[model samples]
Target: MFLLFSCSGAFSEVVMAREKATGKMVAIKCIPKKALKGKETSIENEIAVLRKIKHENIVALEDIYESSNHLYLIMQLVSGGELFDRIVEKGFYTEMDASRLIRQVLDAVNYLHSMGIVHRDLKPENLLYFSPDDESKIMISDFGLSKMEGTGDVMATACGTPGYVAPEVLAQKPYSKAVDCWSIGVIAYILLCGYPPFYDENDSKLFEQILKADYEFDAPYWDDISDSAKDFISCLMEKDPEKRFTCDQALEHPWIAGDTALCKNIHESVSRQMRKNFAKSKWRVSRRDVIFLYHILPKTNSIAAATLHCHGHPHGD
Candidate 1:
């Protein structure tokens, strides 16, 4: 089943890699030189925010490199795949399952807030899976749109994926990390249902729906979900920025709030095991490895001569 991982679309530079020795996979998101749009600072900013963050649920920045006019980000790859694909494959999450998944994401975000990194993009594509057997091992990746708190000045760029972009961002307001939390709400809703809460062919109309803050449930599916799940999502989707839950506080909310004693203990044990795994894993590489990638990477938007050796050998990446 091992094959060279490649795909093309908007910003066709992106590619996936699966490490052979460790059976571990990772996504290598290349920032094309021309796509930089006179904004080289974002690459630096993303690196700054990601390097300081470390958590079980958040994808670890494995390495960073630049070369051939492109920047290469070596990230922990989620193998079970993107959450959006899962919804497409299975149609929807069965209430408790969706809640469990979103709750773990809240935990990851809670950790990020502690480090003051707001992941500007928190949609299903960015939420990755480790293995089909290990759903709880999901990790949040993609720090390209991330922002760090108490650093310099607030970012005013009105850039984010249309559907998941928070309304405040579209308003072009100088926004904070809270923008990320709003996106999380959108993800939670999408996971529970088969589709997003709001949909419109007109981007403006979609923005209006988001601003108006109305979610509709048509039939049998919404009626069958739990009040607790609905209430938690409502709490997250609040339009008023002041009332929204910060990541840390969201972790303790009732929907996710269980006695943390067991989860905490289990995570600690898992950490110990992860470190041991890290030591023995054949795919291990230091940040310097990514700097190597930076040197080898091509300058264009396409993945020209991107040897899969970034993962292990010539065939995988």
Candidate 2:
């Protein structure tokens, strides 16, 4: 009963397959054996992480099967679309709305960290809606870069989308699950202002900005954003990972748990900026390119070099 499908990456495609007997639809990631030649461990790590995670805000892996030349990973189908798309479409967006979204993400990442799993790559594209319903909860997807802690040395990979990566990661310093918290802060900043905290077409400049933790809540775009919201982002985006707010601390902050997230509608400004900044073509950079550039940059370079085009929309509603 495999019918509908969509290409998700270079090596694997996600198909909406239905179980014949149960008549339930699920997303099946099909990976060709040839594609697994040198990346077997990465695939195994992703599967291992998916298998153990059962949070409501995180996608679930239902089953796994191997064919003669392919491996199939059955994942819970999520169809609401990307987080940015929904925010851009909403007519009455506010700080409260952004707060709620970040809260869900924080809770999910918190659960992962507690279990010793670090989601090294957390970005807007990976946050999907469970269904098309207006009130559907967000679901986290794409754990290909995630790593379980205590299994190996501390993570020092210069990975993650350029705009949202933590400073420690860009500095090539050993990092913890705090990297996920930093990404959440970046997302929160964009949700309120309708643009990334850091942006530059040049990979070097972009990495330089992130490495220095250089960003601002510029006027007009951030005029309506509450101070509490800015404070919240600052805490998570702290240059020192050791001082960066943990998921638990972020959740307890007034902006998230209290009533500081303003209710004023900022959709006009926020959505307009979002559409201008996050066009489909601009978000098409390959993940492989980012990783490749990170590994090849000279150790003495001013900053890690990596082009970051962004965004992804999940198929199957």
Candidate 3:
């Protein structure tokens, strides 16, 4: 027995539920079978990946059930809300705070990479706080885009959210877990400046910028950011995946390990920009399927565009 709360999003109904047997709380992802047509394999893949992983910073897939009409996924309940929201609510934020957050992500991602898994999508929307506490840890959710390596298949899928996707993914290059590192760089950049590293109103133009790794630490916004912070992001966002920093390398950077990450409060400017730039319907585009259909499909022929529209589409969700 479970009590269904309000639906969380339009794509899938992620409602808060309380288990009657154990009196425990959880999040249940309700997916209608009709919506899963032609997407069974993707759902199976996501389940397999979630089943294999166990990390403190990753949302745990507690259980799964299949009724006559729907597939139910029981997940860890994380109510601390989104990462940006937490930062915006804080009265004092600093480079050190951002670095601490990034460090946790890097540590979790490093664990995933060690297990031959790549989190193809690592955007802000997917990073959630574990609980409604001041010290709540960040938890990485949404494994629909994750791919496990050593499965005798090359990870060449042009997947992941556009603004946060890696350069190679946009270029349709055969990529590695390094793609996750690139995303971390993008996240780190945003954490510091409160905006995306690469952005353009036009989708094609946005892809071009990501393809070229075209981004700048612009003036006023970056004036107060530490040089080490910039360098750390530069290493992760390097155009060449070969040259990009690994999670291990990033963890050792002065910004994360040493004293380079300044303690100066930057909440006013960073939160202001974050609120303006990430307002609803402005930057949180949940149309990864469209990107797959219109852009990635034509460039790479391995994956069919129709199949890419499934609930497992890597762009979001």
Candidate 4:
């Protein structure tokens, strides 16, 4: 009943299925064994990052089933399709709609950064919609280029699309979650002006414009957009990575501050609810199986350390 999701990096297809027993609809992502076998470590990292997260704006992993080689993730599927298509058809968002979408996307990014996962690729294509209504919910999907930092060393990956990539990322400098915000700025610019701030027929010229950080504004577009919106985008798209607001800080910007209660609820866990579900599970395991669960986990670090089996084997799922 639904179309497949296709992008450059992911050969994996999205399949619509109904559970035989419950007759419930599911959107399943299939990564064939051959396609992922050579990239086992990356697949594991994606799974690890996705599992650590829980939020309304971030795509949820409903279940994960793995075979000897392939891995399948059943996720919450949004029916409204990608924001890129919307932009293509309608041109851009009005100020009111842009505010709502930015708030939702920031909430998701803040949660991910807090969990030590950097969504290396954040673009219009990666933002999915929940329905056709104007107030439709949004989510971040496609974890193929995501990464988790485990060490003190900063990451150095020449990834991300041209127009939205941060200066640090394009310069091949070590960078962090700030790169995602750079893309957010680009999105805001498009939403307000109905065009990207930087574009060129030549790839080199496009990179120059991105690094130059020059954006266009005319009374027609700028007069209607609030300063809070412009300032928030400017603060996030700052040239210096350190100066840019972390996802947490950006969520509190004047444009989105009123809705922080929505963000707070996402990180708050209901252990009581989880324990109740655990009791109902047919597959039982001992407390020892978990080894240990951290009572408190901050946003900047991980909840647990890597485990070593008695026979000297590394294991994490």
- Cα miss at 24, model 4 (Å)? 1.8
Off by over 4 Å in 2: 1-10, 286-317
lDDT of 1 at 148: 78
Give TM per candidate: 0.71, 0.88, 0.88, 0.72
Candidate whose lDDT is highest: 3
- Model 2 TM-score (2 dp): 0.88
* Predicted structure 1, TM vs. truth: 0.71
Q: Number of clashing pairs, model 1?
A: 7
Question: Residues 85-195, candidate 4, lDDT per residue (tens digit)?
Answer: 454444333456666788889888888888888887787657778656666798787676788877565788787766778889888888888898888887766655555
Clashes within 3 Å, all models in order:
7, 1, 0, 0
Residue 278, model 1: Cα distance from true site in angstroms: 36
Q: 1 or 2: which has the higher TM-score?
A: 2
Q: Is 1 or 4 the stronger prediction by TM-score?
A: 4
Candidate rank order under TM-score = 3, 2, 4, 1
- For all predictions, the C-alpha RMSD in Å is 12.0, 10.6, 9.5, 15.8
Residue 302, model 1: lDDT of: 35
**Residue pairs in collision within model 2:** 283-310
lDDT of 2 by residue, 1-317 (tens): 34333323456665555665466656666676787787777888888888888999998888888778788777787778778889888889889988999999999999999999998879987888888789999988888888999985778878777788888888888888989999999989889988888888898999999988999999978887899999999999998888999999999999999999999999999999889888756664443311111123333433322222222321110
| CA error at residue 166 for candidate 1, angstroms | 2.3
Lowest lDDT sum, 10 consecutive residues, model 1, at 308-317
